[model samples]
Target chain A: MQAWDISFSKLKAGYGSHVVLTDVTAALPAGAVSVILGGSGCGKSTLLRQIIGLSKPLSGEVRVAGRDICTLPPAEFRRVRRRMGVLFQDGALLGALTLAQNVALPLTEHLNLPAEAVRAEAVRILGMVGLSDFADFYPNELSGGMRKRAGLARAIIAQPRILLCDEPTSGLDPITAARMDDLLLSMHRRFPEMTIVSVSHDLASLNRIADYVLVLRDGACVFAGTQDALRASDDPYLVRFLNRDGAGDDAAAGECAAPAVQASLDRWFAS
Target chain B: MPQRNADDISRASPPVKVLRLLGRPALRALNAMGSVTLFMLDGLRHIFTTRRILGRTVRQIYVIGYQSLFVILLIGLFCGMVLGLQGYYTLVRFGSVGMLGSAVSLTMIRELGPVLTAIMLTGRAGSSMTAEIGVMRITDQIDALDVMDINSVAYLVSPRIVAALLSFPMLTAIFDVTGIFGGYLTGVCMLDINEGAYLYRIVSSVTMTDVAGGFLKALVFGLLVTTVCCHQGYKAHLRRDSVGPEAVGSATTSAVVISCVLILAADYVLTSILL
Candidate 1:
């Protein structure tokens, strides 16, 4: 597997007319962990989707390695896409398949491996994710964290050079989230040249695993640089985000409350 | 304040407003038809191009064909028995009770066999296809496939469509046979309409053209139903009627309704052509 640098040159993306990411321009480094930082609905997932070629950008270019994927023909783009893996939120493992079967999908679909070889590879990946015991369990039977691990196993089974994770630690307990972060780090160690890009708001995980950071806010890329640069910056929005400020929350809380709602709450809880 | 009607809303004349109302749905229906056709073509293309499709296709056949056998048998038997009873009585009225076999066999072979089989499968397998694909769409499994550089349509839909193609005619034949037997139970066993007369008329009245037409209808109905159901599920995310989990339910409902309607409509057209 060869790590591929992903560069977005003035990329704009969204569904139909509702633009979620506007004029975004940044390059995620090859052979390193780059964390995309943003609040919910701040175009983090949209950017990840654009990079993964799940949806084409409305305008501009997304270059993988050196080729602009947006301009590539469908057949050509599919070849480029084969070098990548994506871990979606909620795991997104197929409910019909067992954990090992889900993990084996990429290999079985893309390669000419025999059944035993594919199973062996799947088991190895599952073991990496610490899900060897639950190989036969359906996705629905597993907990959310376990499913996420299985999703990670499936994503990396083919040893893709470019790995994109969408909020990988979003809904996990502290211990599980930490384990997931460590697992991602270990993956980077195993595949030293693999480029790992994660979309997340987890400051802790970002601090631990991120070699580079790209922060998005209000449909724009606010910052694209090293984590140290992001930390040392004095920008107000960046400062607020980095410090986990509650000022915006207070303002939103003010607008969200009403006297009618307060009165209803009082009446309801009066008993 | 008074309640406003369509005339008050946009200041358009009644005729223009009516035309506007009708045009919107008419255009939407046309767009849906075009989309379903394109989806079928795409799925059909993948049937030839996808590697290792046989295993998936066989699995789908088991689900869509083998699993539906009992229901098809049950429905076919009842349909046949009802036809025999009704045909027997109707012929008895004209002192032509011997025509019961021709009536039951011809009816099953020409029309009811293919149409009922498709409708039954639409309810049984078609709805499941829609719901399953719809869920996949909502849950990002389809996108997962896309990210994996695997053709989601090839993986999810092409197999089902191929399975339906192979399954529909076979099931229709079964339905026809079961229905004729059902007719025998009612006409020959119950009414004592002369068993040989019943079987002999069935063989005499059913021509090769009739059987071919029935099979052709079966194939077309299978394609239409499977394609429509899969399309609804595949594009569940784009549905304007709902979003997220609700979209899956809406897509499934729309798939089954649209499939059933298409089956009946296609049956009419095919029957007209075959006749």
Candidate 2:
């Protein structure tokens, strides 16, 4: 199935008028894990939001599963969304619910599973994510890694075909980040047809997990190709970003300036 | 090659700049009005899903509404005593203790019960709703729900509005009953008013219209508190400003203020029309 071929053409998204994404055009191959590599304010999350249909694009088309999701009617849009899963940064677990309850939410809301069946499924997913022992715990009771594990369990509960993760490794220690990478890769390996896209500024995590990569800078796609191609290119941006060096030529130093901002207006307005 | 041409850039007046800064969000909010109305309409549509939503709503009423009954009763009794004490003194001076029972029952049932109970909810439930949804916004749970193809407003706001509409009137009824009983207790136990006559006057004087008006006001008040709180919470900035916890505090405070304004305004209009 060509269900995983996702493309965005000149997509623009903003919170109100302060546009976070400006004319971003990119594509990711079917059933491949694509990491959106970027600095803060580079519209990585905004791109994810547009693809997920949370925020409407100002101008452009996002073709996911070969349909224009932005213009789809409500019922159609919901059908599109049902095929997706999202692991929000900060682990987005409901504080009011237990970890099992959080994981069971999608099953309860979208599936025909009986309550007992949902409970059993929730336990299975939590066990898959290494959070089985923590099922009865509330979000406040779990550690950061455990919360992320519970969040992962929730995202995959409905076994969506497309998974979008935002900053999955942030606020995590290196060991935990590596563990999360293993978990993500294992998930991909288990369902080879799953299209997984993750947003990350962490080069190490991206390098560890991303098969196909798109480097976004200032709300536009700078590069979209394989991780090996990105590494081999003489693009100083890829170098500095990968090198984690603060000292570099201005353009390549992972700087984030909102798109279409002129030099004069940029300095003048920030004053 | 060029000196900074600060003079080249013209600035709008301060108020104009502030207005411009606010304009986008204001327009966005205006655009979202359709969504809000649709959400409210969806709550009304729950007349079909009553088996599900009402069961959920009634369960919520048990947890959120009736669980607070003790405090409501306490406030009602105290409110009645104060009204009674004031009415007794005022009526005694006019030698119109006969009118005291009528006055207390009518005001308590038609006005104070709904108003006071709503004010209490503004403190109790309104602030809580703001906190709950605000935390959800900051934590990105709201976004997760959106990505899951659920209308966050319908999922979050509709249930709340339904619960409030159902629960607030029930609470007001209890408040009205306890408040009148409190007045009776004061009149019969503490004062020299004939117990049977006082009870009779309270029962006879309060028209069905008065009680119905109070319940109607309760419904409106409930909608106001839930809608305003949910709105404020929905708009809670993901980034809490350097002004500290001011945003959450302000959301809660705004819920209370907006609820109070809507209730009083609705009270005036409803009383004018219905009474």
List candidate 2 segments past 4 Å from native.
A1-3, A248-271, B1-39, B46-51, B238-246
Among residues 3 or more apart in sequence or in different chains, the pairs in candidate 2 whose N, CA or C atoms overlap within 3 Å are none
Q: What clash pairs does model 1 have?
A: none
Task: Give lDDT tens digits, candidate 1, residues B224-262.
Answer: 999989999999999887999899999889988988888
* Ten residues in sequence with the least summed lDDT for candidate 1 chain A: A248-257
For candidate 2, what is the DockQ?
0.50
Could you say which candidate leads in lDDT? 1
DockQ of each: 0.78, 0.50
Candidate 1 chain B minimal-lDDT segment of 10 residues? B1-10
Clashes of 2: 0
lDDT by residue (A90-110, candidate 1, tens digit) is 999999899999999988897
> Candidate 2 local accuracy as lDDT?
0.82
Give the chain B TM-score for each candidate.
0.94, 0.82
Over all chains combined, what TM-score does candidate 2 have? 0.87
Best by TM-score: 1
Candidate 2, residue B98: the lDDT equals: 72
